[model samples]
Target: MMGKTWIAAAICAAAIFSVFPESRAQQAPASPSVDAPELAALGSYGIGVADLEFIDKGRADPLQGADVPRVADRHISVKLWYPAAAKGGGTRYRTGLPGETGSDVPFEVPGLATPGAAMAKGRFPLVILAHGYSNTPEVLSWLGENLASKGYVVLAPAFRDPPITIRTPAARAGPLTSRPLDIAFVAAEAQRRAKAGEGLLAAADGARTALIGYSMGGYGVLTAAGAPLDPGLGGATRGVLAPFVAGGPKADTLKVADVKAVVAISPASNLYGTPLWAAPGVAAIRAPTLFIVGSQDHVVGYETGVRRLFDQEVHAPRYLLTFREAAHSIALIGAPPAMRESFWDFDWFEDAVWRKDRLMAVQAHFITAFLDRNVKGEAAKSSYLDGLVPNSNDGKWPNAPTGRYAGFSPGAPASTIWKGFQPSRVSGMNFEFRPGEP
Candidate 1:
């Protein structure tokens, strides 16, 4: 079988134009720049980044081939993005994106943040990012960089995944068991190193922390943040798929305490027939959360996946943001130059029902509001979260000017504008909230 990157690129591209051409073409903005719109719209800080590696001695090397000697430990690589002083020259970094075999699509993406730049004054809250299966940290850099600029330290880790041509179920067994464990491990590691003033980690506040995850990552954060797992899950009898089941010998170690908030995008809650997290299981989550998913997500079923997960989290104050007919890629980093080689590759970043830039900008606004309110204790940010309108387009006045709408403008009444959004810029989205049970 082909790599997941290639398979997804091919399958989604055919599905995009055929299923939603009108919607996509209509929403396409006049000129979308290669740069992420939301990344440039926030705070004043320059970004500094560095890479850190950690060894996990408790976990076995799941990837060790039968013929090779068994390895006792697993190593993790993390890329840290933080607020930085602007006195020094910025350095370029590399990234990986999906590409066709023997093609010119480059493996390395040029970085926007400088490497080894001086750390900005004052410690900031920390946000850890975990990406979808077979994806790299660069794929989610849009969020990491933007959050760092907004006075938060962001760390994105590349999870272990099967390489191309090795898509068998056995290849996923190791990563499944290790994904959530990896997240919890990194959270503790980031704080430990930061408090010790280690490398770029010196910029982390560590007092407040949050988790942002997409796809498989959504599963990792949810598990790490205290979602209960089935005691019989992850049993060894299941063979290649056993490592993914919950509640095996390693289940007790997957959780982390004190996560302030969580944002899960298109969470993979039901990858298998049974829900990875049952209602009773998810009810254990204590952190306030924001769940974002497209109503039409094909990869992870909307009703069965994210929405189901959101509904089960009754113990936490939660909000659900639904992109009308958008798909699973609602919040990925912008498409890199390499992905443009084919429509399929481009579909890896573009959503069928929403423009990528617009989707990313909207995500930035809400994410900032959420992190500020929950992680930074900015009480004023509550205005953005409370009393949200169900539909972005419904808040406009009947006779309002063609482009004049409500919800974010100072002059627009609360009834007309979406509480935290600027008028004329918000459309085709829905937001719902459920307060935690006292």
Candidate 2:
């Protein structure tokens, strides 16, 4: 719960259960080669999806309002996955989730829904996800529907604002106002869809909604926390909000108060050059939070911004965990690369690329633990939050930070290792990753 209106509604919704559902999909095909629960347990040691299909972007450029430019009003897409009513039989393919109507790519999925089948329905907990900046909704394939397989309803929307074609001096000058609100809007709509029964994952309890974001989407979570954002510095970080301000500004406010809790991994905030959780806009978030990052991160370094956010927030219960061998995007699990590349130092603030579904399993487990404890009245299981991350065999299978990959060799005794996220005292069968060419 983050937006003011939504927070109020969420508060009222606490007692009202508005679970949505799409008509049951056609029959499922074959049972997945491996049951999903076993797949999830692998996160205990940081492995990834063995064989999963890609759910591509279904559509693009949705809302076309007067104030919104065509470029600004870009596409929205998402994929819906779950333990089908029956196992699937068709071949499995992998693709990004796109909006229901824009640009897209289609492939085989076991007993997958064909375009007009009902959206989906179930009585599952609703999890609305926000992707990082300049990324389509497909970026975090690591987490989404896989979590759905674990009995949760996952909703991921493409909220890339100002769509980076604004590379020119003139276009770059436009104000970036909608991104945060876009997240808020998407969350609200997900609830509406569930309440109205047009949603993908039908088993949704509107009262049990939670927010999960990465990178810029992380900033959107902060903004939704009912905090206020200050004017930031120039260059890649400035975004669309800078140039639109007029005399004394039109009140640059950001916050979302309805979220019961949030899990932000490798979010970007604070001044690039300076350190500290500079995005005070999210400071007003009084809900519980689970913040994950990498000690060895070079992309959004482990210094000022994200660190300060955790250090200063006093109202809500918050925790931060830094993966030893990981970087900004390494914390999740997804598709293994045909070949590995170390572009950790690539100028992402200025460029863009597709991050595979490497961290989904771990992302799903940690996030599930957070939601269970915070939104579902259960307890969280995190040793790092308790300052107990083991020094030896942690079951975390996170990717090393791009710049930090020493290229020594896989299993070469480097200073870092992970297995299913239990960073200390674990074994190999429970994990996957080779830091160097052993």
Candidate 3:
């Protein structure tokens, strides 16, 4: 909530710690002006990452088949950031970190500092990131950057980024089917690159694909995989003639049989059981799913809302994350606050225990580990995913969910999961963060 001007303040207060190398306490190299993306020690998966763009103009299935195709041979552009040859000189971009952008304020970091863009030499496992409604792929860049930093090819396409020009209601109705087409287009393009020898991202091992989505995108991954996103529930038409944000399969299209796994970040499936994505078929989606929601989030009604969509109905791998003290926005990387128009003072953001970066770590760890286990076939029973381990951090807050989780240890009490009046699942979502062990 503190504007960009605070960066100077955070820096000034942060400066008391000493900037030179040697031993201010631990005796390390100079202080890093800002946290850099951790890329050196990638997980078991290989390394090197870079930016990539694939033609996502797959043809739209004009026919009624559930299969999706786009209108352009080269019209749709799906931008992909994947593990690459850590060697190429990829162009640099501004910090994708949210709030750090410094409101309409001038840049202050000085020097053309750059965060590393990932690139993999050979074919790599692929993960697709879907941004929420009215949002462009750029908004999801933080997630893309995280996974890319960890060595997975991540693709974020602008399926809903197009400008709206509504002429007729039917015209609006026509593209509703385009969302799935957009994702299929992205998948097909990644496959195409492998054939053209783009690298590991191109030659994925089997259908080693994983989808991470939020808000409407939260529904997009489900609908695209055949969950059927019915009317109003999809959140595409927020109000009148608004540009139609692309999305979904009618009902029973892809099936849980499609994606390897899914990480629904604050998905809004308020009407999961109604005519919109009927609970039965939608719940049947078999892939492992990790329903992550911020404790303060009303969007997905916490993970419980997502659980209701499948809870007893699901028969595959499933997990959940409640970023203690996190607001709904924690689920979205690089996105401006989730409920920007709440009319409430923005200070509420800083009042919570889950500071911005800490919440991001909560989101990133669970997601990356989820895919790493399901897609790359990393051993399941991962401490992070199974909760067999406690979340920990090295003073850096990326792994902390709530500020408490910032320094929690495994043997620590579950008390962290219960905040305020004791965390009663019945009372509402948990407002606790458990920093998973590194």
Candidate 4:
């Protein structure tokens, strides 16, 4: 009887293991020979980081009811990453995730930036990074630090968003109104500091600015880049968002001045049963844009959400990079150690089918190219963003000699593979570009 019971347990264990052989590792084995994408590699400059706090005085708080006597001030926290002289050490950032009991589950991430390091010489383009709802800037330190090394002043704002579990209309209203407003306020403040030659931001170029947002943040950058809001948002936010809608008294405040480029990743566009930006509203976006989303994303959706938004923005030259079979987690880093214990927490930063590091590398590569070409006016970088085979699998490198590894794709008539991408590293993706109307 004892032997039979032991045999049954062993069989059950074997069945479970067969079904989920890689569950422990959570991702496939790293490719042995595939080299990192070209633009994804760190740039020449060393990185520095600092924390800043700003207050938007006399701002209306949508979360607070009208019954509240005084208008509330909006306090924003920004994480600044910039080019700096090479310093030996790095920073380990501590942040929190939403816990079940309405508290935070703290975690830590390692970073390449040296805190309080001396700023590198030269004024660089400003890039405002807006994270997804309830997400911290530390999670996107991957992007912030990488861009800083690449000669950009990156500012990632903490929007203080409500948890995703909160389903009330009131809960939705706060983020709906605050996301874009926070982005605009931060950009304006950063630009002002740059103009005044303020500390840390002294070398920032206010004229050349780019906005990059993921998910809810994606919604923010689009709005901040001059995409008009739907009037329906007013009633949805219980009239709090009315003033910021198109043609409203505060409509102009929603947009950042002189925006050179915009990047929206898995942006939430079709919210509340309608598209967030109508065709006319999206047409108002003049800056060149890049839209990155997973073809199978279920959270903000794919076909009806980001893809639809991309299709509507006809007046802006835009590129859409689709990660086949990937999902909403494409914008963030791999799940931290604390988050890895549960599927719910892990899904926040990792796609089930794609490795987070791979996704981030691809993202960094294209984002660097796009920002360089559009914001810095580097015409040469345009080759990296355009003229690729739409479907990566269709890309051909037919004439390659058998013995040597093919490095970066030569592109065009020489090889159809994407520019700056290694041959083995270029599958499972699609890239498309459309020119803005005259």
lDDT of each: 0.71, 0.45, 0.48, 0.84
Model 4 misplaced stretches (Cα beyond 4 Å): 1-34, 66-70, 100-102, 164-166, 401-406
A best-first ranking of the candidates according to their lDDT comes to 4, 1, 3, 2
In candidate 2 the C-alpha lDDT for residue 367 amounts to: 66
The lowest-lDDT stretch of 10 consecutive residues in candidate 1 is 28-37
User: Model 3, poorest ten-residue lDDT window?
Assistant: 105-114
Error of 3 at 341 (Å): 13
Question: What does the lDDT read for residue 12 in candidate 3?
Answer: 84
lDDT of 3 by residue, 1-438 (tens): 568778978888767655532122121111111221121122433223334555533343332233332234435556566554453333333222222232221111111112343444455566778776545555455566556656667777765332332233333333444445466666666656656765545445325778788776776676655564554533433221021222433233333233787877777665333333544435546677777776666646754665465463356556666555555665433223332333332332332555444455445555766787877778842533553322322112223355322233222234333111111111222221222221
TM-score of each: 0.82, 0.58, 0.61, 0.90
Residue 312, model 2: Cα distance from true site in angstroms: 1.9
Task: Name the runs in model 2 displaced over 4 angstroms.
Answer: 1-39, 42-75, 81-83, 89-122, 160-178, 199-202, 231-257, 271-280, 331-360, 380-438
TM-score of 4: 0.90
Q: What tens digits encode model 4's per-residue C-alpha lDDT throughout 4-34? A: 9999999999989876634433321111114
* Model 3, runs deviating above 4 Å: 1-74, 87-119, 161-178, 195-203, 231-258, 271-275, 310-313, 334-353, 387-438
Model 4: colliding residue pairs: none
Give lDDT: candidate 3, residue 241.
9
CA RMSD of each candidate after superposition: 9.3, 17.4, 10.6, 5.9
What does candidate 1's lDDT look like per residue over 17-38, in tens digits? 6757444333212122333222
Give the best candidate by TM-score.
Answer: 4
Residue 91 lDDT, candidate 2, scale 0-100: 31
